[model samples]
Target chain A: MSLERIKIAPEMYEIMPPEYQDLVKNATYGNENRGWKDIGTSKELIEEHSLCAGCPESMAFRYILASLPAPEDTVMVGSTGCTSLVFPHVGIHNIHSLFGNQNAIATGLKRALTVRFPGRIKDVVVLAGDGATVDIGLDMTLQAWFRQEKFTTICFDNELYANTGGQESGLMQKGFVAKMAPVGKTFEKVRLPEIARESGCHYVVNCTVSKPNLIEKVIKNAIHIAREIGPTYLQLYTPCILEIGKNSMEGLQEMRDSEKPTERFAYREYISDQAKELLTEMAAKEKERKAEAKRQLASVKA
Target chain B: MSTSYQVLRGPEHFLPPAAASMGIRLPDPGQGHIHGKIVSEEEAMEAAARQFLSAKVPTIFPGPLVLWAWNEKAAHKATAVRHLYETLKASVTSTQQAMLIPMPDYRPKYPKINPEVEINPNHPNLTIWHNKIDACMFVGVHCHQANLSLKIIRGGTDCYTIAMCAQAGHEDAMLSFRDATAEKIMRLADWVKKLKGSVEPPK
Candidate 1:
């Protein structure tokens, strides 16, 4: 995933497709300030997604990919769902092995990467849908967190099995009438954030894709914490427009509606004392590094 | 796979070729060559057609792109795949379930297509061995997934692999078809139909 590895041969540049050229020129391979605002302006690591138009999951995917602190050294493990549909289009290396086993795979992958590159930072992330995270893969997902695996787990909680035709999922709201819940859901949505916090995650966040800056901050914080401390989880409310019978343009409104301060999906965060200390140290170090770089640039200009 | 770079100290740092374990070593990444020699699209399709018609157990391993959201021509490609399947009477063992369910609700809608068997994307070689598949073609699979699947099939079985992709062809596949458009897939089906008409089925 190093930038040196992605360099193209000079002779092959003329024959390479424009997309490849764009990737080499404009990709945020080594950019320091990676964020969601770079979506349209930069040639993103994701070439293009195959997800439905105006899908909040897609937006979250874009934000997450953009907010990765080190795209050159990140390996994402995704499970089956609407999220898998877009994995093929992402430029970074990703694995979509089995249904609901993303966390288990990421656990192993993170450990293996640690052993393989002791000096380098290789961040492993698990990205999946609500069904994969809270239902079928719950055991493995919780196991990874309990083990304190050094990686980030982000659930694109669409509330139902939207990829499998809108079946009621564990993350679905109580009384929601979905395919498997013809008489309305019998149980309340699973409290995964609280479970993750208790299960040993150093950092936890519950939010939505309605705000890109918040998404960037949480994702970056989660990755940073996971790299130094322990496991981190982010549960994003990405509503399924198709399953909810909302038009393509209404996904954002649905997300905004669900993320009201009093609503279940409202923004929340839990950080351990160790994680807090590490973040404060990291912030001060980053500021010092920026100041040093500024001083060096001024000297060159002088 | 972990990459280890060697630096040559000089006026300018010279970085040697990537040394990565468990990664495909592409001699020339831009060139079509990988596991086998690069061949033209027509040549690759011709070989694929011949293999399907002549093999005792020929299988079409359709990926999600055939029936799902690959691109605008995914529906057309699926139709061509169906025609090719009918012409060769090949058994279908799809890897679409690697990341998806093969139920009626999750099935492709344009022209409903179904596989004879669904194999896990991670261990496709198991299906190849169990079914005694001699020749298989990967249609509409993602490049990265196809690369891993091809290596697995190559490692454990003697099945000849073909990669039919819309992007640059895979280097791991024995026969690779690049820029595999809907019309090209139909042409391959037509070629297989002609070849099948001229030959007797293998027992």
Candidate 2:
């Protein structure tokens, strides 16, 4: 009759496309069996859906789901965009909201689950677009991080608005020709990764779609951290293939070679270090305070 | 029975539906007014022109020209705005201008006008550029970016105001004309061409 007894994670292989099943079979994050070298794996997820062929968004979406700490224990929140279009089609329980609300919804869900399941973990991930998180959803996204909510936000950064026929998003970099700025966009890219770090997110990663192996591995570690760490944001640099001209598998390599080193943003690991230091400092301070109180009590008794 | 597929599932296979975690985030009160007298299309363009002219300091272009416009209505309208900004040289007029969104295809066509700023406000170029503007115009800017731009300008020591959404809400203009139709936006373009019409590139 225990709540713990009732929980069961989904059978990921049955629902996932065959390509991922083969990919994840040997993949293990933070382990020696770094399944990246399994070159025989197919590029696409092999799902029957509306997303463009070689869509970077779809590729990252599949990899994140496959890398979950426990797929059966997962509840996905999809925002209104291309990701939402495919969320229901995937074999799992997912909640959909209008653009910009995915993180907000995921935060509330995590709080409720925490109280209900106590210390047990059920993965809650916000699968959304760059426009949703960096543009329309920025406020909600920042607030979620501000509160240190325990959840994972895997943002598919296709650079601009892809689902709506290619408009410039806040994520748009300068001098890029978009539907609105056909001549070219005049502004620079929003430093979303820096914002994630500044807003107190527990784990922040900025990587591209070219490396599914890296994407898979990062997500797996992020999921593990989310159970205890406050919040995690995985920004996958996926460009809309139709507009950008490269397939999803090679999106990273095809992306701006000049900007790669800067965009990669080697993992900060700031939150992990801070958390350890805070716990140690707080424990020491509490022990001393308690000891001082006990000494006062002994003196009074004497 | 020896199972051909060594299927192993995590204990969370039986988790409940996602309904347990859903909620909404409503916007806080906006300081910039959304409702007022719906000015005439002509009047809206006139106001937009006045805003463009009012820039005491060179205008700051905090951009995001969304390449994906939703419907026929949005598509044509966004194109019109693009045409107008190019005529205006909004980037060159900027004390600071941003680099392209890092998508190579989007960059090659447009001429480079200013040094690029990283997306974050803390970027030194962004801070320096944002600080100098006495007034800022949010042409083709989205809400998230509008908010960030507002935050940066507010932090500046000088008096600053938003020359909002290119149209200043003229009757025919989309609440903010930056996202509207060509004929509708042509009104502003006409006004700019007429007024700043005689002005030449800054030396």
Candidate 3:
């Protein structure tokens, strides 16, 4: 018998609890495969999970997962592609459903759990790949949002069916090239958040994985809104690492260096502020229209 | 000549007789406590690590850590396992031990768009083989260390172990395992390496 005692640093032990030390021991003994970087982050309070390492959107989802409250009651419905890969590694309770059926399954789960357990369950989150949400599951998603189902739906918009070897998805940007769309995708990318808003979803937000902090905040807020108000749609910009011709390291760096900064500046300096202003203007117009319609109805009745 | 192992036939092929063996009754399932509290980041880390340790077996020696981030509400654990494998460069470890044990078969009961049905029209054998592959992939990730060897009975598959290893800067184990399984022992030995700084996304 070979006896090898490894001594961990005092600082490391201070940062992590005894349970975590046991987890590392189990991992060593089990020979389980996982991304080293992600496993490292698992030591943090928030843990992110995903299907594809190459997809930027998957990485973004991971970042968002890192920011959420631990012992989360949220259930993630992963459609096919990158987001599907996150489930096993994250160590959270999750469901891997068929492609494009995340919304329907999530809707059923939310209804069932809420009905059975009542207020015990917190929220249901659907993590969809571009192909599943945009191409196949679009109809179900629309119905779910239109019905105002109580759930938080996140679309990691990577512009392709990454797991099936980078095929073009309905959400593929105009200039993007995928396996099926070798030359370029002719269809315009679907602005899913705007569609959700029009479909009568109570809340909608679009952000990229690049902004880890913001993504976390948005996820927390989205879950809250889903529970308090109704359904919430979050369109996340996730990059594809392999499909986009980059390795995992480069993909993460790209998200951190460019995606996060750009998103922060845009949301803080322009989008959110402008959105508030626009909402105010829209509310005034709606009031005027409603009053006019009431008067017209009254006059006709008279 | 009849097989010499006739005495060990039928359902009792492997297990010892209950009357003659140590019969320990497991605790009732639903009777267990259900503590549903939101864990802090620190607590979550500790819990993940502890769970990892409890689930691990030492037979394989330095198995890859399988981290599962389950979304509790969906009741869909299989998809989560698949997603974990894809993102992490991990494979499902199906073993015979898992088969003998009463593990939950979390495969979706509903109809899915089976790729094999559409891709191969003429070749029945090919379609069946492909379907088996798909089914295996779906159920494989949930297989624990003991069940890993069962995956090999089907042929042309690997039985990998799953554990949850969370430490500062130990993220490279996945890549290290991919590069060299032989180096896994050394990697585990070096688990004490501290993360250089905070794990913040780049600005």
lDDT per residue (tens digit) for residues A1-302 in model 2: 12222211121113222333443343332232223343234332224456777676666666665555565467889888888778745544578877798889998888887788886667798888988998899999999989988888888877788877788887777787876558777778888877888888767777665566777767766666676667888877777776765565665555445235564433333346654564466559769988998999999999
CAPRI accuracy category, model 3: incorrect
Cα lDDT, model 3, residue A123: 65
True-contact fraction per candidate equals 0.00, 0.00, 0.00
Question: Which segments of candidate 1 are over 4 A away from where they belong?
Answer: A297-302, B1-203
Number of the top lDDT candidate: 1
Q: Which stretches of candidate 3 lie over 4 Å from their true place?
A: A1-55, A247-249, A252-302, B1-203
DockQ (model 2, Cα):
0.01
lDDT of 1 by residue, B92-125 (tens): 2232111111111111211112223454355666
User: Residues A1-302, candidate 3, lDDT per residue (tens digit)?
Assistant: 00021222221232233444544454222121122233353453224333444556555655655544432355668877755655654434578888788999999999987887774745678888777887899998999988889888888776687777888777777788876668888867786767888786666776566656567667665665677567778777666777777877786565555344444213421123334454466559769988998999999999
